[model samples]
Target: METRQCGPIGRPRGFDADEALERALLVFWEHGYEGASLSSLTTAMGISTTSMYAAFGNKEQLFRKALERYTEGPGAHLAEALREPTALAVATAILTGTVRSTTRPAHPHGCMGVQGALVASDSGREVRDLLVAWRDNSYSCVHERFRRAVDDGDLPQEADPGLLARYVTTLAFGIAVQAASGVGRDELQEMADAALRNWPLT
Candidate 1:
């Protein structure tokens, strides 16, 4: 049996390697790395084992590619939410959006990265590191927004940007977990709103 090759990260030449990666990503996202068996991946990817190995290198590499794809997809939106004019506004939007997005009827599996980390034993060091990096990056993005808000006078200069950023991310993470655990939209929105109202005003 011939192995199928995964195409380039963005654009492939002849075959839709990128598309295959996306399919594989969805399977992993819904099932988690451990739950997504090699057979399942091949079936989902529509490629044989040889091709899967040739294109993705290994299960680990495919998982990494899926993470990359997620960053390019969902992470882009999250980053955009951090750009709101007011820090509090941006924070609220992000928090609410996260809960809404996670709890949407179509996406019931929660965050792929968060699931990967919480399950723990299934992923390797690299996968864990990638999740950590994403979390750290998210906090930094929020922190930068807070710093900008302070400069723009929306927030007080005395507010600790780092702590504020961490808080925003922490709230977002809590929402993700809650959404995963079947939290309702109305209730989640209330929690998100209260969190925004508590933002340091000084």
Candidate 2:
């Protein structure tokens, strides 16, 4: 007897894994993990149960991968904005950009992560923890940037970067909620601009 190669050949699924993950992510983003049933994932991912299990493990594991992709893909821009030269610009970009993205025609319902968290229950500990951690880390990153701005004399010496960072993060999340609640883009932009202007920069 001779050992034989298993499954389809020819570059080993050049279009399968990536497409499946993308589809699964879209489903999870659209509907929270609990809400996105197996049938939904399989239908959206275009993969059978066996294939999904073999490629992405169990449901929880697959959900984690989807969340990771979200953070690394669609959500990456917000992290990038934290690297702006000044705290004011970073805050402005984070808040205003978020408002624009959330209220855009393509994503008018608001942020996937924020919406998912709101629908989660106590049993959804992993998902809740992931969202909280992501938000906390965002604050930390922005706080460090604010600290750099203070050190560079861009912001007032007496300004507390830590508090400012938390405030900015809060404002961003609040704007996300407002967008979800039917607040228009102009109002959110004005709010963000006024918030940025109020930052102490003596």
Candidate 3:
């Protein structure tokens, strides 16, 4: 009888790639990129280091995919906010969304993209830069949205879209930091409401 060769061993039983990525995302959200060690990630993903490597390439690549998932999942508010009928509404949605997302009861208490790479070591420099670029892209999108608002006469001719976008994003990032510091959602929402009472800040 000819000996039959066994096929390559498959992923460990009960492996769910999406669920694994979600778990990894939570780990990174709580621990940041550099702080999330390979051991921790694999453990959270419920897989061996070898399995992690085969599925996600490496730690850095896993982080990239986690960030992408975060953008589409928890960080989707920005895209949705941009579609509001007016710039003020868009800003409101953005701030409200930031407050809610950063303070969710069962999730990490901060924005992953904000806290993911605030300060990375030499090995984490690429991730740090990646976050910077990610944040800049968000700013650009808001700036362009506000510019369109100006063109549509939704904002005053003197309204500076760049400045407005900066103001909003800065506030949103600040809210994330505050949430991470244990600030309550109600208080943040109140503050956000107060801040936007006079929209298109001069």
Candidate 4:
């Protein structure tokens, strides 16, 4: 019996894993999971098939890593926004931060998590679920923050925290799509500011 070879061919010639992942993330962000091929990923990452396999295991694993990078980088502001003392401040921060992140000129125009898989396919269920889970977790943070705000008199007692959370998150997802559609950062920021003006008062 003979042992079979697995993954790609040879060892990684040379490439910065972070940089490569960033490139791959952009490809995925722009084209989505199903649209992005291994060839596109390798070309953008400046690495060979074998190198990507050696470093990131497989396409799915590589996408997971890229998602991690996205959350830690562009999406990191959500953590701070959720910790805001007032619900109004929390909503403002989330919307404004979303505008900034989605419109960053250096990277792809939208958020990797939100815009990456808007139209999920049957085979991409796992990755799609992961994105949804991340979005839901972020929403929960907003809900918790608003609940605390209501208890502390920052938000009206009758206001629904879940609704508030969903509203702002919906705005965020919309902003991502608009940014990806070529909306300017200033335009998006203005839209975000207008949305915050609709924030419920105590």
Considering summed lDDT, which 10 consecutive residues are worst modelled in model 2?
A: 7-16
What would you estimate as the lDDT of candidate 3? 0.94
> In lDDT terms, which candidate is top?
3
lDDT of 4 by residue, 1-202 (tens): 9999888786745778888999998899888887899999999999899889988999999989988888888788898888877889889999989999898887788888887776688988888888888888888989889989989998888999999898999999899889989999999898889877767833
What is the overall TM-score of model 3 with all chains considered together? 0.93
Task: Give the lDDT of residue 192 in candidate 3.
Answer: 98
TM per candidate: 0.84, 0.83, 0.93, 0.88
Ranked candidates (lDDT, high to low):
3, 4, 2, 1
- Please give, for residues 105-201, the per-residue lDDT of candidate 2 as tens digits: 7542566677656657777888778777877888888888889998999988899999888888888889878887889999889988888786753
**Regarding lDDT, does 2 or 4 come out ahead?**
4
Candidate 3 ranges beyond 4 A from true positions: 1-14
lDDT string, candidate 1, 30-145, tens digits: 77777788999889888788888888899988988988887677545577787777887788788877877667786544677676555456446667777888788888888888
What clash count goes with each model?
4, 0, 0, 0
lDDT of 3 by residue, 1-202 (tens): 9999887695454589899999999999998998899999899999899878888899999999999999999999999999998999999999999999999999999899899999988999999999999999999999999999999999999999999999999999999999999999999999999999989886
By lDDT, the better pick of 1 and 4 is 4
